[model samples]
Target chain A: MVITPQRNIVSRTWGTSVGKKSVIAVTGIVFLLYVIAHMIGNLKVFFGIETFDAYSQHLREIGEAIFGYEGVLWGIRAVLVGSVVLHMWAAFSLWYQAKKARPIGYQHRQRWEGSYAARTMRWGGVIIALFVIWHILDLTTGTVNPLGGDESAYLKLVASFDRWYVALFYILAVVALGLHIRHGLWSAIQTFGANSALKQNALKTFAFVVAAVITIGFAIVPLSVMTGLVR
Target chain B: MKLTLRIWRQASPEAKGKMQKYTLDDVEPDMSFLEMLDVLNEKLVLDDKDPVSFDHDCREGICGSCGMVINGNAHGPQKFTTTCQLHMRHFNDGDTIDIEPWRAKAFPVVKDLVVDRSAFDEIIKSGGYISVNTGSAPEAHAIPVDKVSADDAFDAATCIGCGACVAACPNGSSMLFTAAKVTHLGLLPQGQPERATRAINMLATQDELDFGGCTNVGACHEVCPKGIPLASIAQLNHDVLGATLTGARSD
Candidate 1:
């Protein structure tokens, strides 16, 4: 395939504010869906070690006949990684633009009294990104898992959460992720052009509830383990 | 009412601006904000001092020329009101108000309380002109429009290009202004042929002019003089994506 060197419509728009934001909106939805799914899978730990461990192994076995061993799992990982790269790229680009546009701020720049979640979107995103790395090391790859990679998924989770510091960190990261979602979900709704006067209230409520649900769902596991409810 | 006013003073575009204080007595509650400024200017004239320079054209709030940050909020504390129409009644007797130019890199200060806003014109020009045949006036009923779109277009057409949205936005974004134009034209039958290119060029130019990226802070919507809704930005975003997917060519 010969790629034309000349600037085309696609290339021009891709570097623009609309282009970058559209990208963020699309990738953000992917993460949103993935987190909800991951939370539901984690809740399976309540069903006992056997069922939870079975679920973890089942992720690798999905579509075994058609895609071969671990193919579907790898595919999911590929999409997630791609989403992360695009999401961060667009987010940083927007951040740089915003910073450049307002070199001189107001002497008494009255805060718009925006939601705390909206105000902390950038820093919250950074915290969430860092947490993703730690989470992958501890749970997915088991490189830092105290119980080791060879142990059952349930045991690995329990062992990681059994440490008070690890559990506290998990709760902190979960809250940051939730706040990120609270702002991001509504921003995505606007970017997609689905927001309007009539639907604004309902959609705002929906975004808040979804963010709250995801935060609680993830945080509960670490709390349960620390409290000895899931040991 | 006696009030202390802290106004930004910049002699030239290259000069370092600073806040200077002035005491304004005999400020009547019925006097418009600009009228109060006139009283202050008269006092300066008698003192043989250079008067404070600000932008104002139509004091009735129709013209887009008058805009400044009053006490950190764009167009002062009133809702759906312009600085030209903001009366003195809103302020307390002894209130100390801070007045400054719109502080965005895209909008540079020209003098005291006045900033260069031609960047908005550049963004408007890049959107390209509508293709209308030059001839006698066409019949009114020749091209019919539905009521909903017509009303929506009119609602968007109310934008006066005052730059209040930029002053109000945390990101210094001009999306609301660009969105108003795109939505006004996009909703009409005459705007169809160039709709895609309009969205692409206008948005691209807005970015090129060094305006900030919009994060949907909702401040712009709240402080808008004409009450332009945040949904107009959504509509503009919708048009942009729709245009891109169709492989529309740009100039």
Candidate 2:
């Protein structure tokens, strides 16, 4: 069969940096929302192992009445995977575009402009990507988890945190994620054309608060587990 | 005053460029940066050597024709000053200044200190103008623009198309230059008809020309000779988003 040349809207738009930026902004917000929800869900450990285990089981049973078991969970997973792929694609393309813009390097340069978060975006993204892979292996696949898949969700969490290195790594990853979210949120809003001189301070504050809350919220889980507070 | 210059010398656009050293004595402190270069060029001419070629139209700052990365800073260390307007008094005796052209792929070097900035012109040609039927000059009072908006428009309009913003940008972004034009037009009544289309078209051209994305570095504002504020870029973003969402057409 002959393949037809079809011009998709995405292909047409993604040809430009502005279009790529729009993709990045939309996908970034998706990841931000997911992280916030994940943090809250993880916090169920504070209510006891039954509550946390029930919460984990509830995620798998979502939409079971209509679509059968694990259907809604798969749906959520699909969306998240799509978002991550799109986000990474846009980010890499943008980075390439930036590199192409300046073919030569400066003999002497100074970082007189840009924010700390803005400067660290590339490295922070790398850290987060590495953390994501390690996290899935340890928790979801039970490959590196000390308690293994046979144990309860609460027990696995405690077991992983009891290893000091694992908890420290988790804390570091969350901190990097926090920095990424802090800059990403403000940049996304600006990209979407939601910023102005009058609203600059308020928007910045909102970005900082959201990032801090999510990071601290996630960090508290591993810390509590390691301290035996949750165990 | 005495000074040492490490100037980039490239024979042509395709030629390999390198830093060439030169020492100048009795350089008056009152001489402008461009004037200092002129003295050096004069010396080269007297010595029967090929003088350094740099672009300059009006020696004044309004033309935006003259620019060089002086000592790693666009237009030198003086804030909001053009290369032609920078005075040598800012430097002391025995200072070594490194001079190089803008190092963006979008701006290919023409010679020693000049780069092709026709990309900026193409961006303007895309959609930086409004349609008008020529008849007679309209009265100034005919259009009643609010003072705040009129001032803001004037401020944005002051951008001289100087590539300093791009040169100073870490990513080599032309957002400030494009945004100045977009925001200037978007704020006016006459520009309202093409506001949406102008934003979309100009930004599209800018991207096509291979300018980097703006990460809100604020470098463009810092190095702008006209002191164009970063707010203009925000307005440009606002306009582009509105145009894209509303599916505005250029026709």
Candidate 3:
């Protein structure tokens, strides 16, 4: 790529917010879709340990085991990773600039009475990131104890959720994820140009419900395990 | 009504900005937002303080000059009014209102609530105008334009370039503003000759400008005083992608 001084200087300068926001919105949509797909894949855990592990193994053992090629799933992962990077970079850059614009606080009673969703977006994101890190470690690494009971990979999941606090933390994280996703999803659609009042309201409501379902669905398993509803 | 105002104060572009609070007692609810600011400035001048600076031109809604993020929303709480047209009646007595410039990388603070939006001008300069040879003005009736197409184009053309869309957007994307202009010209019969080229140039320029990519957030259309449709953005994306695919093969 040709790099003129003006182009290089302009690139370093803070670009327009509208432009950045659009990128954020589009990348956000891609990330959300990936999360939803991931959540659905995890739903395979509900059936039984054999079924859950088999499902996961099937994902890895695709093509050679069944279809004779692992093409589509790898492609999907590649797209998901690309979208995640773009989404994270855009979000981080926008946040940094917003912070840069203000150096000091005003002596007014700050009130964000009307916009709870927008205000919590950043925090929600943090909570989700932490949760993802923990989740990956718990499921993939075996570094954390699933609980005090079984050390077996499958048994760890069931055993770990037995603790009320740990299970509750998952539940809360899921709730935050729902709230994050609800606001994020609807906001992305709006950013992309779906601006009718009726449509906006409808999508906003739909996002709220979808996020709620995904969050609750994932959270329920841990709670069920803690209560001995699922052993 | 007595209103407490928290306005951003910055000495210069490099100086760190802060929100300075002041009280305006007996503020008339009927006064426009700018008029209320004027009252505050008069008081500041009396105290030997420099008057607060903000952008304003043709206080009517038509001019795109006046814009500020008031209490988290662009152009304040009122639905369609620009900051200049926003009235104090919408606020409560003794209510402290927070005000700040449109926060974005592309828009730097020149002064309190006055941002340098020249980035927008640069984007426009890149390919926003139709290049035509100098000649007599074309007859209005010579080129027949469908009323609906003309109206849609006019509606898209109503973008005031206030940069509110960027401020409201989560990622600070300018897709809506740039897309609106692209669609406005691309919709017309006269614009067809340069439509493909215009899309490629404008889209590429928009990316080159370091503006964030379109995330499809509808905040731009929501806060737009001109009510620019978000559909135009989708159309612009489609056209840009299509143009890119067909325009040429340049490695």
Candidate 4:
């Protein structure tokens, strides 16, 4: 029952809601940048298998002169893993705190305002989490990918998306991700104190545009594969 | 005007409450919402029944004491109006108004339509003050403040410590209320010394309490009687960030 402030500044910040929201905002920006970069990389598939495969190889070969082979990729992987962990931790703790705050429900509750995206943030987050796990297994590990671990990266991607069901799942996950990003970006901006009265509309529009582009950008790869355009 | 009322009735904090319906006749449209309640209580007293209990003080809407969820809206259906100031005219003839207490774990029901809002006091007690020595009053222009900042600070200072923000929020967050206090002081030169400390301590106190985390749904400002802007919350975030980054703990 005795609650004392943590010794470290970081841990102390974690003890407050504002601190948790800051974590969510910062980590969200990291994910946002990663997704944009990922979408651009995925678009290389349109240039044929050589360009796509070479692009994949180039990612691993980044910082080769200084960090040695695969060192930069591993570094990026480490950062991404850290970001995901912090993001999920902050999100879950906030959700738990919110649930604990309202032990009783109103007999007649109404959400006349607030965006649909904001309302569904929790469930959208859950869907995205599940999707990320499935995505890593399918593409990164080649465990769930139909092409197995023997095929090239391009071939594995093509093999997986060539199936209608797999492509459908990817599309659905991407849609959920779009909704998450839409609300998360807006919320993050507000949390970081970047929003103002004059800039509110602009920020909202930017959120929608980013969400739409990322969703459609990611969706195109699987869709092209299924439609025989990438073959 | 005639109306039907479905008011939440709870005997104690642990009692299981439910909606008890009542029919009110000879209701006047010009009567304030609280006056209608008073009439209802008189009838209940005449019938030898326990009259409903609710909070009210300075019924002119200055004091934040009066608050209730009327027809699913905090402080009644009218925008930017307190329960006491809300008139029966807003309700149509024969309308059925559903009244409930402010629902939040931090503010438990003391009785029907009355909750213990001392959690707000704890948040204020944490840092909502200036450490000024008691002596002769200082000169009016001892410390000059800019017009904009002063105005903004004044706006934030209008917060009445009402729990309506928490009651209306889907998450039951007190961010708007806490943010108003933080911004009001943080903007002033006097509040500069403890700016970072105030942010950290007050936010920590809020976390320790049962109040929820803010998701920036922007519902709090809508239901707020004083129309406290969401910008105050943005200011709160700015201060908290600075405090955390600098490790500014008063202790």
* Model 4 residue A231 lDDT score: 81
Please, what are the lDDT tens digits per residue for candidate 2 over residues B1-251? 98999999999999999999999997998999999999999999999999999888888899999999998888899998899999999999999999999888889999989999999998998878889999998998999999888998999999999899999888889999999999888899999998987887888788778888887767888888998877788788888766666667654
Q: What is the RMSD, in Å, between candidate 2 and the native fold over all Cα?
A: 3.6
For candidate 1, give fnat to 2 decimals: 0.63
lDDT of 3 by residue, A1-231 (tens): 222222232232224344444666777777777777777876766777888766666666667664455565676668876876766676777666555433333333222222466667776787777887887667656567644323444577776677677788888888888887887887666555454433656887898888888887788778778767677
| Per-residue lDDT over B1-251 for candidate 4, one digit per residue giving the tens place of the 0 to 100 score | 98999999999999999999999998899999999999999999999999999999999888999999987889988988889999999899989999999999999999998999999988888898989999998998999999988988999899887788999888889999999999899999999998988887888888889889999888898899999988788889888888787877676
- Candidates' interface RMSDs, in order? 4.4, 5.2, 7.6, 2.1
Each candidate's fnat, in order? 0.63, 0.50, 0.06, 0.64
Name model 2 segments beyond 4 Å from true: A1-12, A226-230
For candidate 1, write residues B1-251 as lDDT tens digits.
Answer: 99999999999999998999999989999999999999999999999998999999989898989988998898999999999999999999999999999989999999999999999999889773587989998998999999989998899999999999998787889999999999999989999988887887788788888998989878888888999988889988988887767666554
| TM-score of each prediction | 0.95, 0.92, 0.74, 0.94
Cα displacement (angstroms), candidate 3, residue A91, comes to: 5.6
Ranked by lDDT, top first:
4, 1, 2, 3
DockQ, 0 to 1 scale, candidate 4: 0.57
Top DockQ prediction, candidate number: 4
| lDDT comparison, 2 vs 4, better candidate | 4
lDDT (tens digit, per residue) of candidate 1 on A158-226? 999988999999999999999999989999999988998678889889999999999999999999998
Isolated chain A: TM-score per model? 0.94, 0.94, 0.79, 0.94
* TM-score of the second chain, cand. 2: 0.98
List clashing residue pairs in candidate 2.
none
The TM-score-based order of candidates, best leading, equals 1, 4, 2, 3
